[model samples]
Target: MKGTASACGSATVINAIATGEGGAFAIDLRVKSTVSLTGDPSEISGKVGNTEEDPELIEICVEKVLERRGVRDQYGAQIETNTELPIAVGLSSSSAAANATVLATYAALGGEIEPRDAIEIGIESAFNAGTTVTGAFDDAAASYLGGGVVTDNESREILKKIDIDPEWRVLIYLPPGRSYTTEVDVERIEFLGDLVEVARESALEGNVFGAQTVNGLIYSSVLGYDSQPALDALSAGAESSGLTGTGPAIVAVSKEKNVEKIINVWNSKEGRVLKTRPSREGARIENG
Candidate 1:
């Protein structure tokens, strides 16, 4: 059997670590997975095309999905993953990988998975692969569903979905470090629960720009990440700017004519800047 799938990446508007209420928007960055099952069910393997490191997480993802289908002993596969998103940078790379892997594996099994159910399974696979805490339903949902989502992570339910404005350009600033999502200090973030609640309400009220700015500021302060980049983006007239995920990456949105200003400011900061747009498409099977 053979199958393929793809999923997008997202930036944080509100980290779900606080308030259980969080918001995020999908980006054009993506991870793609292809699964080919051979004879030996014990001969499982995986390869990641975008990085130099081992693809252990992809292997674990496939294993977990097979286990979920109660076919752990019935099949073994060679999985290949190609990604444009960076890992361990709070860009939801793991969630995207897991989501794509789950879809590809199930497709290889000739099974149909409901959309949200597939994302939930991907979240479970993340836990099994030791990649996420809090299930990261907010990130997983945005990556799987596309567009923007405001979620109740405690309930694993998306409370609202917003249509993305095509004019909004997404710029991701990649600093020089990596922060693992599962290793974050949740207590430190939760201390700002009351503030996060305010941000959540702001998103609910259609003020995503304000919500993201505040949430990013609060998290950047408590998490020891420099907030200067976001400030610079705002000074350049961005619609919204803030720390995305944990640290080392900042997400800046702009619909104004001053996109060059934002890009120039980031380029001057010594970190890489990736330009992408809002994604309105979610994970789907590419082939079988």
Candidate 2:
């Protein structure tokens, strides 16, 4: 596969911000992209597929975007993703993949697609490809910019950028089970939308610790998942604790000194634990 464009990765809070909207926060993590177009157009596949509201649709969506750009098909392009982020566990996997694919495709073509434009386009692709519920521009932007961001998706505005104090570590708790954001019934959560807005305001006011913790509780109550794990994190002296995106994965924010205690408490239960820090950069393009 021939033309190439690539971008970095970020995380968003999703539907937790914006008036009459939801909450989202983007975190910077590891991300890179590579694109190739050859005479051979190979079928791409991964653990992510159309089954169970598969978040892997982000890859397919990128391919479709490439096709729409008319740079592929005639020349053809292939995208491969390698990341530590898990799918359907509310970790912004789709947003990261979309950011990488679009930026790599642009790089391969040697054209100019501003980072902001690239992020907006990637969000649109996720919507068109049926992988997202509300276009998820907040998540897309965080995935694009790599620092903490609060965005209003409906108005297409960024309300704030929070420079996470590097002293903090983001510890994520992943249960063996998976939950898809696309599969969630928005109408059922609509009643809780007001609570989501409250969380959003706290996030914009530089209360991310409070925002994430409260957002996690609100979504947990609505989604019918256990909030005990997150509570446990907070109980262990974490600076902040809450759900990551929708369900199943609980995030705890803490200083380096508290890492072992947090991990010990998390692993004491039945779950997978990941220790990570905020990524300061977004996406990039590379060569074979």
Candidate 3:
């Protein structure tokens, strides 16, 4: 049996480590996963097309899905993932991959599961694989459901779903290296809980741009990243700008009129820049 699925990536509005509550918006970057089950129950493998492969995450996703369906010992699977989203850049690549893989595995098994259940399975797999800190429910929800989401990561509950202006553009500035979530100092981030809560409240109140800027600034300072790129983007007329995930990748949200100006400024920086729009569509199984 074989199945295929796709999920978009998301940018952070509020990192959850500080407050256990977080917000994120879906972006156009995507990850696709294909699963093929083999008769040999002992042979399981996974490969990533663009970046370094995390076989443990992929394996756990398949295993979790199979176990959920009570068919873990029935078959082994081969998983292949291809992504436009960059890994370890705080773009929700791991969440997207896990979601797509879980969905694909379910499709291959000819079964259906609640969307929330599927997302939880992916979250569990991520935590087990050490790819996440607070389970990243906000990122997973945004990537799975699309648009924007405010979530209680610890409780794995989505507090709200938001719609972003579709006309706005998202600009990402990827620096030279990647920062892994597992490597982050959780205690230091949590020290900013009081401030992050203020940003989280702003997001809940629909002031996403302001919240994103503030949250990004907080994480950037605590994570030891340069905040000038975000400041530069804001100076270039971006609607909002700040660090997206943990570090190293800055995101700038802007109107079409300000996009070119922001891009021009970001181009002068050290790393490359990518332009995309907020995704309103959720993860789905693709027809073969």
* Candidate 2 lDDT trough over 10 residues, lowest sum: 3-12
Q: Each prediction's TM-score against the native?
A: 0.95, 0.86, 0.98
Each model's lDDT: 0.86, 0.68, 0.91
Residue 249 lDDT, candidate 3, scale 0-100: 88
lDDT of 1 by residue, 175-200 (tens): 89889876788887788899889989
Ranked by lDDT from best down, the candidates are 3, 1, 2
- Clash tally for model 1: 0
Which predicted model would earn the best lDDT?
3
Residue-level lDDT of model 2, residues 30-73, one tens digit each, is: 44445565564554433332334443444554565557577556
- Model 1 local distance difference test score: 0.86
All candidates: CA RMSD in angstroms? 1.6, 3.3, 1.0
Where model 3 places Cα greater than 4 Å from the true spot, the runs are: none
